[model samples]
Target: ILTTLPRYPIPSDILTKQHVVHVQISKLPTDGVGLQLLELNDDFQFVMSELRQYYDEIKKLKPADEKAKRLHQNETFEGCCCLYAHFSENGMREFRRGIITGQSNGLAMVQDADFPWIGLVELRNLYQIPRHLVGIRQTCVYGVFGGFNMKTENERTLWDGICREMCRPGVRNVATFHRSAERIDYSGRK
Candidate 1:
């Protein structure tokens, strides 16, 4: 999809069927916790379908021949994560992997406020802001492959930690990386 759309941002990660199978069969032993892949609920599925339609429109407007002229940036200006289409398989894996890949890497998925994901086709009117995966704002999905499980009872630990930082003056983009994943304050920063 990116070959056609320009500067698409990645929004969230997903667990693929193959990944689940690989973990169930090949991955080494850990804490012996059973794995659980997130199921797309009605709302998420609808949002995904709508997002795809928006991208399809972009493909229609921009021809594949124009690929070279595209801006060609696949990451966010914040550098916390790479931006991608919300529908791409690679994007989904990146979201999951960003949190679980490293020995202590883990990212807390947070709900986005005033998320610009709805009506992406219309959003294109604001062409200045491309709706890539990072545009999704809210990431509520989860898939435990090896060991990136949410340590606290509520997954909002990271969200809470970053809440104050987010509300601070002039803090436009706020994110916690996998390396600092453990720093998410389950204690509720508010």
Candidate 2:
């Protein structure tokens, strides 16, 4: 698939490069299941409307006060987003979101002007890479605003199990509460 593009997709190398799309896939090789999500540039605003709407939900989860707004007042995010996906029990393909979430409590609002993820756009340009690709799996990312924290042993242990189990063959049940940041196979939902 990547051959159609100008280069083979390398996640680390591509991130180092401009305005390129980062597509992460979570796959269960034994089950022939996979979810693919593209991280686009801010210039692609049309694709980000749903993800941007999550800011409203986040605000509602907080107290009804100005302080709550200030906590995540930075209304702009430099990264891309894919909000929803369709699932089929019959014969079809799926390209969805793969999110690793942490415990909910306290505020984890990040507003970095020069987020490292944003620099990836220019790096891709340097290598004459295309804007679209299937990025290498990024199992661990830190210090980024919307990334997981791999500091504690307990958290690390928890994440290890989650990742392994999610990729297992019989794990057909995929669920997520972050509607805008994830894609849930809701076919069974009443």
Candidate 3:
């Protein structure tokens, strides 16, 4: 018999200097399990197209002019209320909806809508999102994946294993559930 449950500490390296984006849940996690999510693919695509056009317009401006424009935009927008272009690890970039949560020493801490991490982006990378695009709702909804009774030793071990795997660098974890069938796969990024 267990007297109390053990609390596991989140790995600091996994989310160092990052802030988790808060999302509203229609129902609490304790209400049920295996909840399915429907993403608005068409709307997401439309927003990406619009962002591309915005980026192109910025590119046309002179380097000094562009820097000034971005600085001005950063000062005007509120935190977590606008979209921004975040460059990927491969040098390619993707437009993610984020808000400037904080700034210091010319770097802005951005909380991306879909990602589980906050990005410390350079001020030059920030751009002004068009007003029309800012009002579009987020396309994806985030959720808690599992509900475990931490008092049980077996469940605690299982949860620990899952956390460790998710913390690994360059490994993308994909979880897909349909009609009660669940699949989880991990693939390494190049």
Candidate 4:
């Protein structure tokens, strides 16, 4: 559906005016289910209103105080995103270099690229390669954030599996690839 411009909680005048209209599927007598939602519209604000409501909920979760405010300001959750990638291999390589050289943060690097590729790195059991993709090689290497300390085995397993799977499929296409930087953002919230 068409969504309106985004509004954060701090902007009361603009944020309060917008309401999120959610359309859900319902089981009908004949039809098994139905899909419904407001048409995508640029004029109607959508995600921003919902984010504000979520922000309010998060704020209320803790005791009101300076500590709470601080927590709210820095807290990270699934919905409370900082940044991530959705781009290409060359783009990811550039991003990795920037981060290693203190030129960018993980979030900023991923978001900066036109299509963030590191997003696929999040997959645990399976490998995700862009099917029917053009350009790029299969042997390209990628490093996941917090690889050794947090999840040494799972991380290695994922990489190895991806390598094996890609070789089998004969799809040597790396959309996003990068090396690890020394400085790390432990929180992974952003």
Candidate 5:
């Protein structure tokens, strides 16, 4: 499991999902015996402003001409692309940052933060992320819910359920675990 720590001045090693980030967390490995998150050093507001700005910029991008689009599509199918794709989770569909890990027949295998399973997405659902955004690292780190004894079948089942719920789309409160319980909660609006 991974735990997030609040570091002062935002260490250089810490990477954010967006270029302009107000709050950053340092991810570290945990022994699975402590709390899932640590308290932040300062009060911070978690907002989707950066994400909204990203989508706005994406919307402004002009569609590539047919020839160029075809070339890019071919590259993607060959697993030579790290691009954005429309992924569906918990009945919610949205574009997510992913890379083409593998391909078979007409489907491309995609890996992204929204789900643990590798998604098989059609070529038409994939889009080349704008060049500027392609370099940005993923905002959240993947971690399993701790304190479960996987040796037992029952515990394993429970652990899997917890992970499924926590990773469900539109759940912003997972990131807020580092904040105090009394703090105001914000919905992860798209």
Candidate 6:
């Protein structure tokens, strides 16, 4: 019935059908008792590692595109993250193999702040005032293979980490816009 009605595909990182390996430590992992490390299979670990690597790659892109003549060289401009659009199966596979393929530059995903399952799309923009800077902002959707599993508090923490990693001293600014219970506007800066 749901399928018969108008429906849109959603992207999800953590799906109920897909088994995810999680490790829990009540106290701390000690060598004898506290140090019990949960073993994650190579496949799961590898997938997680790949996701992290992709995240890193997305963070590294300059805020502005090369074609911008006036603001291309400016260094103080900040970039924002937005959603791209849904990709094909091939594109999804390429995303999964981002480390080896290095073909993430062209792939697009949906990114809607209102939706829980959104993909990311990156764009280039310009800014000037304190300093001229050019860089790309990202657009994101939940993605077909992975869905966000973070809780409200966890989401904040993850956002903090992403901003922290994206912004570095002397580097260009990275801006993030989030709208949920409260709207948060931040320029990835100290």
Who wins the lDDT comparison? 3
**Candidate 2 per-residue lDDT over residues 66-160, each given as its tens digit:** 23322231233223221111232344432222211211233121111111111011111111111231132331121111234666777667656
lDDT of 4 by residue, 124-190 (tens): 1111112221111111111232233324667656655644553453343322212223432323322
Q: Give Cα-based local distance difference scores for all models.
A: 0.27, 0.27, 0.49, 0.25, 0.40, 0.26
| 187: Cα error in model 1, Å | 27
TM-score of each: 0.27, 0.22, 0.51, 0.18, 0.44, 0.18
Residue 160 CA error for candidate 5 (Å)?
A: 9.6
* TM-score of candidate 1 relative to the true fold: 0.27
Candidate 1: misplaced stretches above 4 Å? Answer: 1-40, 63-76, 79-190
lDDT for each residue of candidate 3 in 1-190, tens digit (9 for 90 to 100) = 0000011122233223322222222232322222111234456578778877877877799988777656553353446455466745356776666667677766777765533235677766777667777665554433345466566788768766765665465545443321221221112211
| Best-first order by lDDT | 3, 5, 2, 1, 6, 4
lDDT winner, 5 or 6: 5
User: After superposing candidate 6, which stretches have Cα over 4 Å from the reference?
Assistant: 1-40, 65-190
Tens-digit lDDT string for candidate 5 (1-190): 2322211132233232222221221121221212212122122212124334555665666676422332244454544443443544456445555666677665676665222224567766666654554444334322433355477788767765654554455543333122122221113211
Off by over 4 Å in 5: 1-85, 113-117, 150-190
Which 10 consecutive residues of model 6 have the lowest summed lDDT?
28-37
The best candidate in terms of TM-score:
3
lDDT digits (tens) for residues 1-190 of candidate 6: 0010012232232132232212111111110001101122343344446445644554566745323322332232222222222233345422221101111344333322212222333322211111111111111221111123345777657655643543344433221212212222112310
Model 3 ranges with Cα > 4 A deviation: 1-39, 72-83, 87-91, 147-190
Q: Candidate 3 at residue 145, lDDT?
A: 51
Candidate 4, after superposition: displacement of residue 66 in Å?
13
Give the per-residue lDDT of model 1 (tens digit) for 1-190.
0000111222333211221211111121112211112232343444456555644655566555334323233422222322223322345411110110111112222211112111111111112223343344222311112333456546446544433453455544312212211222213311
